[model samples]
Target chain A: MYIPTYEDMLAAHERIKPHIRRTEVRTSAYLNELSGAQLFFKCENFQEPGAFKVRGASNAVFGLDDAQAAKGVATHSSGNHASCLSYAAMRRGIPCNVVMPRTAPQAKKDTVRRYGGVITECDPSTSSREATFAEVQAATGGDFVHPYNDPRVIAGQGTCSKEFMEQTDGLDMVVAPIGGGGMISGTCLTLATLAPECQVIAAEPEQADDAYRSFKAGHIIADDAPKTIADGLLVPLKDLTWHFVSGHVTEIYTASEAEIIDAMKIIWKHLRVVMEPSSAVPMACVLKNPEAFRGKRVGIVITGGNVDLDRLPWLAAS
Target chain B: MYIPTYEDMLAAHERIKPHIRRTEVRTSAYLNELSGAQLFFKCENFQEPGAFKVRGASNAVFGLDDAQAAKGVATHSSGNHASCLSYAAMRRGIPCNVVMPRTAPQAKKDTVRRYGGVITECDPSTSSREATFAEVQAATGGDFVHPYNDPRVIAGQGTCSKEFMEQTDGLDMVVAPIGGGGMISGTCLTLATLAPECQVIAAEPEQADDAYRSFKAGHIIADDAPKTIADGLLVPLKDLTWHFVSGHVTEIYTASEAEIIDAMKIIWKHLRVVMEPSSAVPMACVLKNPEAFRGKRVGIVITGGNVDLDRLPWLAAS
Candidate 1:
């Protein structure tokens, strides 16, 4: 399991500063009053490439040696990470080959193409993606940058928590949605080192509650297959991420599909910002479990804002 | 006709600095490449009350004397200004009476109530709204704050341009949607004084072209009733606003409903920000007449983001 030191997180911040946006924090009196918590939303929704993935992608690309970077980078993702990698690689004038599932949203695919990514579509199955990625890597000799299992990627994501801490002092708790656990692990590592008293919580969808079950059972749990509107959080927790989360994370909570949709609606109406269902999980958790967050100075990481307009959850009712 | 001096605009900026957001400026590479113009979008959509109206509303509330402010203020509108006034009044701990037309969206009415505004719903006809507002003002002795005709409101709106100029230097032109000419008039006044070389243009919907007609005829053009998806821009340009616009505004451009809808869709897809049809007029003008703006650094004020989700233009097909 890869563990990132505080120094590594600091270095990642400096490296990705120019490439990634220091997304502003959003606060609402209505939300604060309703939740009974002084909430600070770290709007990674506004980050470059429209997600927090940019931090990790930019760091991985820039952290490479001149010779290694010249060969370019590759990744497999059907979501924001693919676009982030493509955007980061485009910025550095390097080639990026993304192995995306054929079922990926057309909007996401178009965005990847716009960012100059070479898209290789494969079946939705993990085996197909891995097989196609290996073939591409072998042909091009490109560096395969793991989305979250990498120490460098985890360190890069930690910078978000670093910025959050600087923006607002003395957060009693920090909550983020857990997917492959890149963001939550990074968040925990940063808070544990810099603000030892701050508790880090992971919000997971009820349909994909591997992390929540793991936290309860005192073991690293894996969901062989998962389903949720939060497609970004469907991946099972990796060993490296689980190691950081198990030791440092205070708890993991779950939100229902209806709660996630409701949270998304609230964000759209109040914040006037679009967020994917995965990004709304933290808000959903807080809304559902208000007692745990009451009177706390809480920080919620809004992970991404790459929702497809055609597939908006609100449209389903119509 | 009351004209706001440049000093008034500067003072308004300082007074409302703490209350209103100095909204971020977003530049679109795709927009620039498509139009052959360097465009800077002054994102007033992200304002506290979800529109540029907050600047004017806050200024009106705070600029008043304590004794006068205690009496509170009143206005009649069916859109952004009503919500802005309510939000501003709530912040100042003053009573707010909004005489909204019965035709106003329930979302807007709910928002007004959420911000502690006393809502007095009236028929959409002029006689009914005026009578309702008169009764409210008579009963409460609150000052009648005209949506855009008052000097303080114009000065407050001018602050948007002041910030825009400071955020991006040497813009060749600035364009904003015209309703009662409040925004454009204020914007023109600021640019005329500070950046005299900059051309100020007004973008109005073809369906509600009172501002365009007024500019061409060199007289106030009154439309008893107008139809446009840009509900906020339905009102005819007022005499006070016409005076400022006629003297400082270089030109008035009109956009068709299709153009406005297209612009809104683009903003939703690329910018990930929701904009009402009124706010999209200026953007539509730029998109429709690219030749007029080629190679110029242009600033476009996105005036509001308070679109009713159920009535969003994109929902037509969905």
Candidate 2:
């Protein structure tokens, strides 16, 4: 139940500096005109590991003591977090064990292995994933780094906002896509202290709108299996992430699958950055509710850019 | 007879500062490992016009005197230059006349028109384009700005290299894809005075290796038409570009169609930048001749990102 402080975020930024990129902040006049908001995109897609997850992964891997580091880290992620944690561990000359569903894409598995992560397959169920990850951690004496629920990981993610705030002049509101709520939670934790005036907005895919429902219900709402084209955002928020989201976030918005893909195309066309569908959720929401963001300085986080080049959504739809 | 001077490039840089974007320089760790070169990418694809041609187009449009500007600027280009010149003219609140091939892609035509460019359609043949352009210029009393041949245009393109040198520590070589050789010539223009120790290398498609052949033959060899997936790199170099290429460029290399697409995929995968196939030639040649670039700092220019999202080359090939 550890709630990370501003000092923790400051420390995480320092700890992860050597291992992660301080990705660029980009602006598009076309997108600004379309949304009627001056949008500043914090391009975490430019991160070395192609996702902002590297920020948290680097912080976790680098913070461990030499003796603890020898045991390395373990996580249950079939997405960018697996690759990012593996990349961070590879950089530190340590082992990283990833517990993923056997049904996960082979491409995802290859990316983790490419970054020196050893994967153990589990049933595509939360209980099975937890069981497998626990076994892997017990056998290797590895530190368990939950994708969003952990204070260290949340603190690491907070550093993205720190950089985002520093890069732009000022933001009236900050927007980030919420899945497990790692990124959104981090945004809240940072702006709560750094720019308290700035409202934190969480965007979720309508198909996977557990966070949106939870915000209205005034409690943690876990979904069994929500589906969306933004595959990375199918997961539910955990206790630690819910703590930040429910308390600090001002509002939650959801976009349809079509809206997400359309927004992805616009960002790719105008911002000229290769980003994921999950990353498009914030922009999709902003475009959906233009009056909420119009004429204001809005900071949008482009969460990741790991997509199969051969399978562009727009190409498939057409 | 109007040869652009290093001082002209300096003046162009100053003049276009308020009009064009000072594009960011990007680096890819994966690309560095793949090519065995410390590669720095000058990302002109991120320009507002989605091409580096904007620099030269802006310089030409902005450098004109009130009388000349009032007459407005005109160009005969069916490529990035047309859209870029139109965008520059729109920025300056002036009329822009473009002489485009009637057979040009509707997307290109639509882009120019979107920016308030007045298009005069001409036959696809060179002679017809020229004749049509001449008539249009006479009708409008517009100042003709050749896409790459003009001294002002060359000087404006040179600003990209000026910023490249300032952004990176010191490149051992600067690489650019050669179609009409505006970008390569611009690199030569800036580096000849700024970093004379650095060599300017030109890359061309095997299908459209006119510049490669011209370099070896020690003369300009204009080709009527050549086909390549890198549609932007099919044009032949003119007298103005040939002047810089013959005087300052150290080597010319050609890459196959497959190689260009492969390099483009690699860039999209690793650099996470949406650039055109024309922009991939430098990296393709670097990979082809790794021995030459190995253990050296190489600067590769990503020329543009105005490709049709639905028609991704790799997707069509597969």
Candidate 3:
């Protein structure tokens, strides 16, 4: 298992700063009063390409030397990471090839194409995304940038927490949604170095709690299949990410699908920000377990705002 | 016609400081690049009661002396100002009686109820509204807070522009949506005193262009019955507000209904903020008349975020 050091995160920040948007920190007085916790929202929803995945993708794309960058980059993702990598690669004037599942949202594919990426779609159940990605990498001589397992990618995500800490001082705890664990690993590493006193917490959807189960068992646990409104958290925690999680993350909390939808509605009604289901996990966790975070200066990473407007979860009648 | 002095605006700022939220300023790199203007958005949409109307409503409620305050505050409004006054009066522990047209949106009426205001429904016609409001005022001895025509309200709104000037060093121009002209009057007064060199522009919907007509004709122009998606801007300019608008406001620009919808979509898609059609007016003005503001520093006042989510203008099929 590979684990990134604090220095790697700092290096990644330097490499990715020019390519990604330094999204602002937003605070809500209403949320603070509701939970009795002073909350700081690290708004990655406003990041370039509309998600925090850009930070990692930008770092991975730009980390290569000039000679290596000329060959381009390749990745397999059915969501934000694919579009992020494509956008980052396009900015560097390099070609990008993405192998996405046929079931991937049309909006995600459209974003990737808009950023000049060649897309190869495959069946989600039968086809090997990795093999397809490998074939593209071999054909184009492009570097493979894993969505979460890569150290450079983890370090890139760390920059978000770094900026979060700098924006507001004395954060007692930092909470983020855990998918394949790239964002949480990077966030944990950065806080461990800069603000050791701050506790790093992970929020996962109960229906897709592979990371939560893994943390409790003290081993990497893989779920055969999972279902949750937070599709971003459907992936199991990888070994490389598990190493960082075991060492630095304090605890993992889970939220029900209903709670996630409630959080989304609250954000829209009060904050006037359109946050996707994945980004609502942290807030849902806070609502479900207010005792753990009450009266604490908590920082929640609002991961993204890329929900399809035509199919908004809140608008759906149960 | 009477105009407020700079000192009057400053006094209003001090009086309403405790009651209203000092809304934050947001700058978008994407908007800057697209508009060819360095834009700073003063987020009044995040203000208490979710609009800049709180500043004026709070000032009006708190400005009353003990005897007058005991009588409480009353207003006839179908939108943000009604809710603002209702909430403001609730905070002061005074009774608020709002006379709203029966045709007012249910979402807005719900907000008024949430703030503990007593609502009196009247016909949509002006004669009925005036008659009902006068009867209510006479019966309860409640002090009437004219939506945008009062001196105190204009002074209260001035504080927003004052804060904008303090937040960003220099501004080439200040743009605001003009409904009944209170916000623009306040903005113009603040800039004229502190940033005399800066241009103050009013943005109005072409469908409700009474302010634009008045600015052009050099006299008050009334729109007896106007129709626009920006419901907040349906009122005609008042005597006191018109005095300030005529003297200090540099120019007036109008945007078509389609343009306002486009601006609203842009903000929702890129910024993830739910700006009402009225709030989008200034942004639409910039988009419509790019040459007037290109390569310059612009300050846009996002006046409110009080929109009926169930019936957002853009959501309706064209």
Separate DockQ for every predicted complex = 0.51, 0.87, 0.48
lDDT by candidate, in order shown: 0.88, 0.92, 0.88
Best lDDT among the predictions, by candidate number? 2
Q: Candidate 1 chain A: minimum summed lDDT over ten consecutive residues — where?
A: A308-317
State the displacement of the C-alpha of residue B115, model 2, in Å, after optimal TM-score superposition: 1.3
Q: Assess the local accuracy of residue A88 in candidate 2 as a C-alpha lDDT between 0 and 100.
A: 96
Candidates 2 and 3, the one with greater DockQ: 2
Interface RMSD of each: 1.8, 0.8, 2.1
Residue B112 displacement in candidate 2 (angstroms): 0.8
CAPRI band for model 3 = acceptable
* Quality class of the docking in candidate 1, CAPRI style: medium
Model 1 chain B weakest 10-residue run by lDDT:
B309-318
On TM-score, the candidate that comes out on top is 2
lDDT of 1 at B212: 88
> What order do you get sorting by lDDT, best first?
2, 3, 1
Q: Any runs in candidate 1 off by more than 4 Å, and if so which? A: none
Two-way TM-score contest, 1 vs 2, winner:
2
lDDT of 2: 0.92
Off by over 4 Å in 2: none
